[model samples]
Target: MNNRIKKIENNVQDKNSAAWKKLCDYIDRVAEDGSEEFSPANELGYELFSQIYTLPETISKLKKVKKVSLYGSKLKRIPPEIGQMESLENFVPYTSYSLHWFPYEITECKNLKDSTVSTRALYGNYKNRMSFPDLSQNPVRYSGETVNCSVCRKKMTYDETNQLWISLWVGTDVLPLLANICSEHCKNALPKPPENYIQKAHKGSSTLPQPPDENESFELQIKEYEREQNTINNP
Candidate 1:
């Protein structure tokens, strides 16, 4: 039996995916002066990335993006600074199955609402109930050193960064999309996170972790599942 599990055999390779190209094209047109709205659109949706190196700078300036969406992006981590966008209202990354957790800074966005996330893409998201990664140990120096995740300047403060944990109660909605958020503040601020999803702050489910070692672990787990399936078939 094939070891592949529902791998999307579509023509949309990461770099060549239609969504990736469109998002890149949009990003490229931005003036980068921080004065423009970072490509204002009535409805901005879908993001596909082959790597995480290009987001921080553009995200820092995308203060005007009110509606956004993404799916199965190569991004391993999202910055907490994303909460700074006060104008943000609708966020839709429904299929970005790779993003695992969020930053403490997303609570800053007082106006956030409406998200479209693929619940199956989160950590403990019922469908993929893989055990959540142990964050009992806070990360140190993920920014400027790693590409999947870029820590905010606020998280760079010596000693202060480690003690910081922000959780927000956004609201109550059964939005599987809500599962994508990783921060406490972002969750608390939500009008309501999806009700049917796995418990909040539980590392429900989603893509693999950011570090290479973690990816190796993910590969191992995948193999374990394959062996189990093989046993069932043999029986």
Candidate 2:
């Protein structure tokens, strides 16, 4: 498994760019045609990465698209508007190594059931605990032009926002989600993460205590067994 953290390209989406226009048009078509699946790479070609680093917020318009296939993309991030894809069910973005955490709003996709993500490349995968981008110092980095309380959905400014990462069940995958909140009350009320994952929301830090991987756990078990054998031999 390639466990090393990739240097994520934080290139902001330029709506005026050709790639943005192309993606917007695609979403418009899907919205009008009511397509069940929407695959940008197939429609835009393998070179789609060269044109865009992230999807357009206009993706919210794809009300009928149940499946989104972004296999093997170079996308750095997905827009918060993805939460508005009310019909989204199967999200397949496997091999998108640079794509790390997802927006907390993704939980709003009530119909989402199945997903295929690059687990090792994810921020808090059980197999590879990659560090999250620290949001304490700069919360706006994860938020959009407007900040809002992830829990209560109340509008707030970036100054009033408190960003934290929480790994919760999103479409059959425990994805590390970025939450920008307005108050401690909201933070306290956030849902508990799954077992063997970080139990609380936290700013991204390499020192954070996460569950050990299988290999590390196995090594510890071996050490314990060896110590027990040594004690028996000495006795």
What ranges in model 2 sit over 4 Å off?
1-11, 138-144, 225-235
lDDT of 1 by residue, 116-164 (tens): 6665544434344333443334332333432221232322333332222
| Candidate 1, residue 204: lDDT | 21
Question: What tens-digit string does per-residue lDDT give for candidate 2 at 117-186?
Answer: 9887788788868766566544435435567678898987777778888999999889999888888899
Model 1, residue 29: distance off in Å is 4.7
- The Cα error of candidate 2 at residue 141, in Å, is 3.1
What lDDT, from 0 to 1, does candidate 1 have?
0.43
Best by TM-score: 2
